[model samples]
Target: MVQDTRELNRKAVLTALMMSRPASRKWIAEASGISAATVTRAVDQLIAEGIVTETAEIISESRGRRAVELDVVSNRSFVVGVDLGASNVRLVVADLLARPLLALEIATPTATTARELAHWLASTARTSAGDVWDRVEHLCVGLPGAVSQQKRTISNAPNLAQIEAPTFLDDVENAMGRPVGFDNDANYALLGEQHFGAARSASNAAMVTIGSGLGAGLAIDGRILQGDHGLIGEFGQLPVGPLGTRLEHMVTGAGIIRRAAEAGIDLAAPSQLFASDAGPALKALRAHFDQALLIVLTATTVSCDPQTIVLGGGIANSLASTLDRYQAALEQNLRVSPRLAPAELGDFSGAVGAVVAALHKVYADLGIEEEAFVSLPGGDALTHERVQAARR
Candidate 1:
């Protein structure tokens, strides 16, 4: 009974710490609804366990008394995040705080199988983690598919070449000797942006990722709105064009390439599609952009009603100059146009989201039930006001 009480107290304190940044003992006590003495004792235990660290000293302006601010000691554990795009695999090794210590990207061939790709990602993550490899507690892979809500299955990644009994998650976990987590790439990208980038403060936002494939991640009321099947904002399959061509097929990097080819522009790679010297190619790209932007804007206005729509992924960055044109087209069509902006995190959104997921997992394992950051409330009148302002 005594042991259980101590454990509960520790958990409460940890949860309070996770929710409040640079939290002091007083703040932890207040937030956790625990006594200051209990918080002090629990914090000492956490520090001894090396899970928490004194980040800085906070001096009170009035009293001039200094209090030590505590934060999660990142290096105590680490997580590996892998974003396996259709044409490339990007890996990031991050500490518990989600700060990337190292990153790597590699080209992936069309024929790569789930097992082979998992092995390569595991090896690369281990290599990038260096001496801290042993400290890695989790591995999260953001793939282009529908991850089962139960977290045991990945389905509907037609581009990955449907495999028979392919256990990519198991293979990766086995290789790294750590627990693995999985999510749809777009969903992870949304979380990454919310945790570390432009939409960090927004309550309702949507991220459209245009890469070899296309998808969207939605955050409503500050929580990632995973559907019943953990596939909420899958905009790729949304029928926007004739002959069953979905939004993804009409707007992604591959789509741009196909459109350019249709216009008699021969492009060897999607990266080369945006070169300034390719004048005819650029013209074709612009036409494709206009069509794609129209679809995305129409979809955003009708579906999520987001305050902000962030454009991200490999193709979005390469064509940053054309963002104005896309936004203008969107505004011209919509009654309440959402704020359009470039993704602040670029390609690192998946990795950062993986880190956030890992940290949440860590808190769960430690029996801490608290949010690590402020989340926007969906039903708040303030949120509606903000959305109205964004439209302006």
Candidate 2:
């Protein structure tokens, strides 16, 4: 019992340092609610393990007491995070502090099986990681599907169904020669925003990605809200209208192209669906787009009651001109509307989010469960321009 109590106190001390490092022992004890002597003992043990280290910088604590600062040994290891989409894979190599050291994007190989895809992702990530590859302690690949980490399986990924299988994660781990993690891409996007993007201050937030397909990632009480089987945010299939048409069928990129074709509009790409002309076909397309988006926003607000709703994915950016309309519609309808905003990270939200999750997993592996949220330090460092600049 004493050992367990001491271990708990150690974790508390470590967690306190993890959240806000370069802190004094008195600050750690106060932050963790652990006694000063216990915190000192735990810090000593952590220093012996090379997990925590005393820094040269010192600070004046309460009553003018001078003490040395301490911090986590973040530079000792690295991790790789991949946002594996159907068309492209975005990878970022980050340190234990969740700061990006490198970022790259590559076309996803047209592999017909999960095994082949796993090999491709592993090799591609290794190449992308470059010099940091050797110190890479963990790898996390976020997929555009419902991921069951416990079962080590992926499902409901229509665009990349070929990569869905029970052993997919194990296959990637075997090929990568390191521990690998998997999760829903949208969930990672939410985490990215919570850490580095617009939703940083929001405890209850939702990230709705309107790209090739529609999906959502919800966070409540500052944690990813994954229901049974990690399927809490599959709001794309929610039906609408008297015909009971699925929401994704009305809002996705493909859906817009198909509808445009049916309406006698020759749309070479989904982006072309939003032309300046207010002709019959274009007007119809815009109306349908607005209505579908409104339905999604309303449903999300009603269900989750998130403090902020971040609109993301490729399509969301394209619909920037119509943001005011959506916000107004929600205000008119709901008693308390969520603060709607565009995804601040632009395209790299998922990739950056994947890095954050990998670091969080590292903390979890170290038994720091109470507070494991990680973030890239400077807000401007995680901006779309900075990430794009790092991309190969």
Candidate 3:
């Protein structure tokens, strides 16, 4: 019990430092709400482990005495992040502080089995990391799927072939020779935006990805909302289209193309169908697309009421011209609606988010849950006290 208490105190001190680095021990104690003696002991242990290090001296605000500053040793270890989308696979190698050292976006392989796909990811990550691969300590994969709470298995992944193969997760970890973590692709995208993109200032936000398929990720009070069954943001399954068709089949890439072909139009891609000077078929397609999106956005607003809803995925940016219409329609229905904005990271949101996921996994060891204020390396650092005060 005493050891557990000490470990908890240590984690609190570490979290305080990570949230606001180059901080004096006095500041860490105040921010963590731990005693000064306990903070000193914890800092000493962290410094010895090479996880935290003493930096330049700073003037103590309370005592007016010079004190040593402490910071997390960000580059001490690395992790590989993977975003497995329907049409492409994105990879990044990042340090403990979630700074990307390498990034790659490539066409997803047409694999017949999960083992083949897993092996491909492993090899690609290693090659992308190159000499830095040796320093990688963990891996996190974000995919268009329903990840189990334990993040050990995946299901409902229409985008990934043979993703349900029993040995797939094991194969990925075994091939990579490191511990692995997983999350829904859209959830990771939301994390990406919150940490580094449009939703950085939004404590409550939703990300809707309209690509080969439709999906959503919700963040409430600066924390990603993972429902009891891990399907909280499964917007693809919502039946909001004509004749009760799934939303996935109404506004998504393949669905739009299929609808266009049925409407006697040959669209090379979904974006082409949204081109200027629309004929009758194109006009009708745009109406349906616009209506479907508005319906989803309105529903999300009523249900989650996020302050901002970031549009993401492959075709999201192309719909920038239609935002006014969606917002106008939503405003008619609700007294207040979320601000609609295009995703800043574009197609790379999920890849960057995967990096955040891996780093959060590392922070979890110190009991540090992710917060919106936890920015990437060299970004703004928010003190723990500030985060708590904001919540209050």
Candidate 4:
């Protein structure tokens, strides 16, 4: 998005190098749509500035010659990803290349209020990140709620109704002295899947996390569709009840249990539900679950036409063996059979998606901005257009 042609050319070349590192100048030019001379100049300038490094000659099979290539220095930069759920919080420290060096989870603050959670987040980050704290240029926190883009405030989180601190985002910044980004957990999971999970190649995909509640994340045309207000994928909030314009009572995992209890059908956690398949609990919920899935799958299919739909979260991961049945039943209602896949990254999708978002901030401008882009691993498949780096 830089206006200057030369600056834009440098950014294009840098992005090309990021996606395909150790790339020759010719490759950089072809991938970035810059003239050979421009690419050469950009690469030369980048190398002279020590922002990019040139590796030893790599043998080129096509040309039958050895050629040196340029690559970003991923090891020098780092980002942190955080996933704060209703009960627990997960933190991951990743290098510029998005490789996780540390990951740990801890219980959330017991107070169950927004201010306490925000304070815990700030203090916990300082403790967990330890020596790597300063190196982390950006921090992305994912949770179950709608976040305002400009303010990074959680106006509404159905599960954590008590959390409503307007300056919570600033609290993290003041605590860490770095840029921070906030987003819903479902969207972060989708970004994680797109970058390193089952949806890596999918241009349009949907991810449904079935845990304490059911939530969804989506990718549209290769970008995370956060909508104008940053809350587009609230599948659990769909109005399925005829009683009023409110969230469907049975659209969540807790809701499922609540509805089942009211109907005199008892159920266990997801693992036990899938254990016998023929177990009475499984049998009892099968019809109801299928009907709800049909509604969800139909909505996702007709609305987004996603090529893949991923299932993840504590419940889904525990009940993964039974996914084929749900996929089969859901496909019965879809116009086209969208490939169903389980989340490869498992429960860590949200945290890793936070990592992906931070890495994206590193990838956006390379060195055009205040903080230079960091080194990241190769095999890139990342998208989230709104993750512009936080300005100082």
**Model-by-model lDDT, in order?**
0.71, 0.82, 0.78, 0.70
- What would the TM-scores of all predictions be? 0.82, 0.91, 0.88, 0.84
Superior candidate under lDDT, 2 versus 4: 2
The runs of at least 3 residues in candidate 1 whose Cα sits more than 4 Å from the true structure, single-residue gaps closed, are 1-8, 20-23, 30-33, 53-69, 109-111, 156-158, 162-165, 228-230, 263-285, 373-392
Candidate 2 local distance difference test against the native: 0.82
lDDT per residue (tens digit) for residues 347-391 in model 2:
778988888778777777676854455333424545576676777
Ranking of all predicted structures according to TM-score, beginning with the best and ending with the worst: 2, 3, 4, 1
Each prediction's RMSD over C-alphas, in Å, is 7.0, 2.5, 5.6, 5.6
- The 10 consecutive residues of candidate 1 with the worst lDDT sum are 376-385
Query: Which residue window of length 10 is worst by lDDT in model 3?
Result: 383-392
All candidates in order of lDDT, best leading:
2, 3, 1, 4
Winner on lDDT (1 vs 3)? 3
Clashing pairs in 2: none
Candidate number achieving the greatest lDDT relative to the actual structure: 2
Q: What is candidate 3's CA lDDT for residue 379?
A: 59
Model 2 residue runs over 4 Å out of place are: 59-65, 241-243, 372-386
User: Higher-lDDT candidate among 3 and 4?
Assistant: 3
Please report, as a residue range, the 10-residue window in candidate 4 with the lowest summed lDDT: 383-392
